[model samples]
Target: MNAPPATRGGSALVVIDMINTYDHPDADLLLPSVRAALPGMRRLIGRARDEEVDVIYVNDNFGRWRSHHDELLAGALRGPHADLVAPVRPDGDSLFVVKARHSIFYETPLEYLLAEYGIGHVVLCGQVTEQCVLYSALDAHIRHLRVTVPTDAVACIHPDLADAALRMMERNMAVRLADSGSTGLFG
Candidate 1:
């Protein structure tokens, strides 16, 4: 509810599933890749803030029925990669959207919120590039929102699958795989 609700006809950055505990089955393998993405993600976040672009963190609720955003954040801070969590943590002005599914727009108020904010374009940056990020991008595309995925800002569980997912998004969803600095949406 922060940041004036929406920026309609503007751009927003959705950080998906990054506030994770990394205690899942594939976590060990995914942690390193996710860490590698921190720099890019941080850079993008900084740019978004500087440009006054909406920074929306669409995180998983970790299946906790009553868990709130702050709780999820605190849990992640206590997780293995607290360093990763700290630098990209959402600020007071940032928007938070708690989701139970992969896609940010799935059964969530993301679509409605974006519409209210007048966000016609979205730049997605976060973990599990092949899963949540991919699904969210597709959902955005279908919703007719201009989608941009900063390649370096998204992490993956498997390199091969991640690459394939990027290609699929590019070809099918018309996603643009770019560097965080070149996203252009911020400027």
Candidate 2:
């Protein structure tokens, strides 16, 4: 994983809270949005891979302090949205960061990892756009990382809330609002 960085100025793709068990109360509400964004997520992921951009999965620990990445994947695969998890499962080459909170950088080595690779730009994609995505974007901004969130690649429970969050990100953090197709990782 210590290879030279890819993409312009060491950019990375951060996937947040996608490997979920969907056993919670809000699971049903979130599922539809996730399904809607699945294709875009897949496209962005493929582009990142093809462009040799770093892919990082910043997933919630789900209160499992000792749980590993495989355990989380297995749990999600056994629950709802197995289809989603199966297709987007992190491969051996992908990096995984177990986050306990909404922000990926909070209590995680994400900052150091990005810094080690000299990654200054992050393209965020995954579930719950209004919460995890919003918070992580803010945290990224605070850390001086150029943030970009492909709107179609992120899922949210409420469309209105998602729009508002995206607007806030663009206005406050100066985050680049883009779609999977408009994101030019290689170019």
Q: For residues 1-187, write the lDDT of model 1, one tens digit per residue.
A: 4233234468899998888888789988888888899999999999999989999999999889899999999999998778889999999999999998989989898888888788888999998888999999999888777889999899999999999999999999998789987846553
Worst 10 residues of 2 by lDDT: 1-10
Backbone clash tally for model 1?
5
Q: How close is candidate 1 to the true structure, as a TM-score?
A: 0.94
Highest TM-score: give the candidate number: 1
Model 2, backbone clash pairs (residues 3+ apart or across chains), number: 0
TM-score of 2: 0.93
Off by over 4 Å in 1: 1-8
TM-score of each: 0.94, 0.93
lDDT for model 2: 0.88
Model 1 per-residue lDDT at 109: 87
Relative to the unseen true structure, what is the C-alpha lDDT of residue 97 in candidate 2, on a scale of 0 to 100? 95
Candidate 1 worst ten-residue window by lDDT:
1-10
